[model samples]
Target: EEALRGLKMAMKADSPAKDTAAIVIEPVLGEGGFYAAPASFLKEIRKICDENGILMIADEVQSGFGRTGKMFAVEHSGVEPDIMTMAKSMADGMPISAIVGTDTVMDSSGPNSLGGTYTGSPTACAAALAVFDVFKEEDILGKSQRLGDKLRKRFDQWQEQFPHVDNVRNLGPMAAIELVTDKTSKEPRADFAAAVTKKAKENGLILLSCGMYGNTIRFLMPVTIEDNILEEGLAIVEQALKEIG
Candidate 1:
């Protein structure tokens, strides 16, 4: 929060960008790596934004639609945002995004002020509607939490067995294993991460790497993936790590 406050202050100092419209953030970062923002940090930012008349926007593009054991990642913090953005899993990759805000904030925008060519296309809307049905019929949120528990247990064991693995982070089933040269030094092993991802891909396990240093292997398994199939995919990852390193 202090770091964010410092940035806001610095931005306010600039005459041109002095307004500081909104502080947008990913509650649980996606491609940037799955570091779930601390609840306290989120709450503090909410307070800061409130004090400065700045909107707090939660970008839940990758962490929304039950991926993080909640409909939206910000819900975990219990801090309502003036504005919220969602995509990715919203329409199951139908290329649709949404920006919802409080009535007061939304009403402030003039008609035709917020829209795009594909904003409300029927195809994407149909997909998003179906997603809502599935969410109602299936226990996706609960399953996500259970999946996280299962993966975290194995990841913890892997950290103990693999010297290069450290900083295993997870929120629901959204998880990542940071590769480091040594636990004490925590020096990012980008090479190791790359090798593992390449090997996993070659072995038919579609894995991805993220983080600022590109040293973290992230998991984005489908919430609907069957338990047996999920284990099979994980076994491939375990094998890849064992063989690559």
Candidate 2:
């Protein structure tokens, strides 16, 4: 809250900071190591935005569409923003994105002031609609919760056994393990994470790295993956880690 107030102060008269427009953030950081913004932080942001006239934008590019076992990650914090941006999983693999906002905010712009050549491309729109159908029929949100539970359990165990696994964080099924050189230093070991990802791929389990130092193993597996397949992939990861050791 203090940090937020300080930021607001920076935008005051004669301040070096330019006049503020809006604050955009990912409810659950994606490439930033699957870090989920704390509920308190999100609520504080909303409060600050409301106190001022600043618009709050939730960028749900990777955390929307049941990825975090919710329709949108902001739902977890129960903080609704003035605007929400969604993409990536919205249309599955299709090229599409959406900007949803209150009618008043949306209508503030003149018709000629806001238009995209592919704003409503039929193919992308159709794909997004299909994704909604799948979500409804398959109960994607429920699946995400189940998958998250399963993965979290294993991650907890891994953290206990591997001293290198500095942190295990997740929002529903969007999970990640941060690597460190040692518990005391907690220094990110990017090389170790990169090697683990490469080794996992060699063992038939693909993994990705992220975070400031690229020392985090982030998981983006589909929530609908078969149980056996999920288990097998995890096994491969375990094997790869053991081999790397």
Per-candidate alpha-carbon RMSD to the true structure: 1.8, 2.2
Q: What TM-score would you give candidate 1 relative to the actual structure?
A: 0.94
Model 2 weakest lDDT span, ten residues long: 11-20
lDDT of 1 by residue, 127-159 (tens): 999998888888778888888889899999989
In model 2, residue pairs whose N, Cα or C atoms come closer than 3 Å (at least 3 residues apart or on different chains), thus clashing, are: none
Q: Over the stretch 59-150, how does candidate 2's per-residue lDDT look in tens digits?
A: 99899999999989999999999999888899987888888999989989886876655576899999999999999999999999999999
Local distance difference test, each candidate: 0.87, 0.86
Q: Which ten residues in a row have the lowest lDDT in candidate 1?
A: 9-18
**Top candidate when judged by lDDT against the true structure:** 1
Clash pairs of candidate 1? none
Q: In model 2, what lDDT does residue 208 have?
A: 90
